[model samples]
Target: MVFKKLLSAFGVGGPTVDTVLVNPNTRPGLALDGRVNLVGGDAPAAIEQIVVGLVTRVEMESGDGEYAGVMEFHRLPVSGAFELAPKQQLSIPFQLPVPWETPITDVYGQRLHGMTMGLRTEVAVARAVDKSDLDQVNVHPLPVQERILDAFARLGFRFKGADLERGHIRGVHQTLPFYQEIEFFAAPQYAQVINEVELTFVTSPQGIEVVLECDKRGGFLSAGHDVFGRYTVAHTDADRVDWVQVVDGWLQQTTSHYGGLRAQGFGAPQGFGAPPGYGAPHGYPTQHGHGGHGHGHGHGHGGHGRGVGMGGIVAGAALGAVGGMVAGEMIEDAVEGDFAEDWGFGGDEE
Candidate 1:
């Protein structure tokens, strides 16, 4: 009994909780099935409520500068209230629905670089502090998302990294407070005009809104700047057309003289032919500048060389296999480090 009373915010004789996910791997618009196991401490405790939430690290802008912090985007109640006797045990099963716009942390079993997700379980006691548990969660891409990412790889875009920014796009519909940006180095073909590209997907039940930000290169007299493009695609068209050609066309249009029009806050040029079943391009006006808030932090575009491209390196392999192993280890370290220490929500209020 003494050993069972490991740790809790309700002092020594308080209940301890452990949340176990039946299957940690899931996709957007899906549900995560799990059970919460609780063991009563040496004394009887009045358990008030139980809750679970989805949390992730988001880079936010402050007056001083930008910093990364854990934010709980969604939460669900598991159990109402109960009274546990000493040495008693109880199990509560729950099904938490993943948001349609949830940022993907994994692709084809590979953890995306610079991304981390966790499911947090919090138990409230009547008159004592709360006890919480954290579990790592892997969110894979939807079918359409997978296809688009595959197209980028095939187009010779090398994966740089990915992170969530705390802000909204001026024209896109977003449910979550923050959005994710998957960064990539420009392919050899477009290297002369653009330095890199950042991809953002705003998904819903019917389809997705694809946003692209191209970092154009600076010439002798002019300084470089970012060009934006927004396009819509239906889920049904995921397999109806050749993605390579479609994506290539998008890059060409985005990096062309059309960028000059976007800089002036204009939509796609008239008579611009979009791919079959795809919506015409629109201008993406980020809240602040290039990356929503301000300059992107923690995303390093140096040291990594341009070579065989991401697709060639992981030919026939998983979608994000380019830096999967290293990213996996990095996620694990985060789970044990900052993620564990910072549960995001403090006390019984949240």
Candidate 2:
């Protein structure tokens, strides 16, 4: 998508900027190619610099409340010093690298509800305010990620909702400030053992690390708690492994044990395998914040079609059941917010 904005910093007849992204759809570790088109106004202006940044809405937790904001995580300077005569036009190109740990915004061409990503363009003209524009960006999942998500559906796990949490997971080698949690409702067979599950993936060049936090059910006279399971899968495995079997085994092992697994020397027996509960030093702690059995909460509705496709990947039956549900209004809320006047981008000084 392209966004154009006038340089109101210089008042009427000031310069304007039109930022165009060749393609907004991309994956982690890939580069987004785009160009910044600038047009001079009535008067000649000395351009100081032009920059582009990748921004997203990140959820944050404070002492008293939780809030979300537009965070500029990656910045790229597109132009240095330049001069634009009256009616002069300039085009500067850029190749911005998407971070390896970037969160996934779309699955199988469908936007994941609750996720919002964008690119911001800032042009700094000498002695004037910086003009800015924002464009939406779609980040698709890596092949491995798609395979895992597909497996969940094939196993009867229903898509619940996804969100970015404020804090870093205890053991995750996190690069970004927040983590994305793709949630799912338990299938009928696993429902007796688990209420729901939250999934997270920390990706690197070598492989992707999958984290599963299952809301395990308690037996008679027992209280329910979360059982955390962590697994690592190589990208090459996307074409070779049976993700459905792998994911099913993960669910089985996670719910099969109420007592901690690491404590008993039991480790992850699925996927590429990491020690059980790899999110912590001694396995997952007993006190994870996600202890709620969140059914009937969040958007898993009709916003994005949970299309049933069965070829290499099988969309689970649960998705077909909830496929028609509407996405919640929260996604719109996340996209609609007031951006900062300056966005921390400095105006041209010379």
The Cα local distance difference test for each model comes to: 0.68, 0.63
* Candidate 1 lDDT tens digits, 1-350: 44534433436768889999988877677788899999987777789999887877777677877766667778899999889888799999999998888898866456676677788788888766677888878887765576677778878888888877888887888888888999888889899999999999888876788888999998899899998877777655544445667778878877787765553333322343322332111211121111232111111223222212333533433332111111111122223335465433111111
lDDT of 1 at 70: 63
lDDT of 2 by residue, 236-329 (tens): 5654456677888877776766434522323434445322221111211211222322211221322322234222132222221000001111
Candidate 1 ranges with C-alpha deviation above 4 Å:
1-10, 261-350
lDDT of 2: 0.63
* lDDT of candidate 1 at residue 37, scale 0 to 100: 96
- Candidate 2 has what TM-score? 0.74
Error of 1 at 88 (Å): 1.5
Task: Give all TM-scores, in the order shown.
Answer: 0.76, 0.74
> What pairs collide in candidate 1?
none
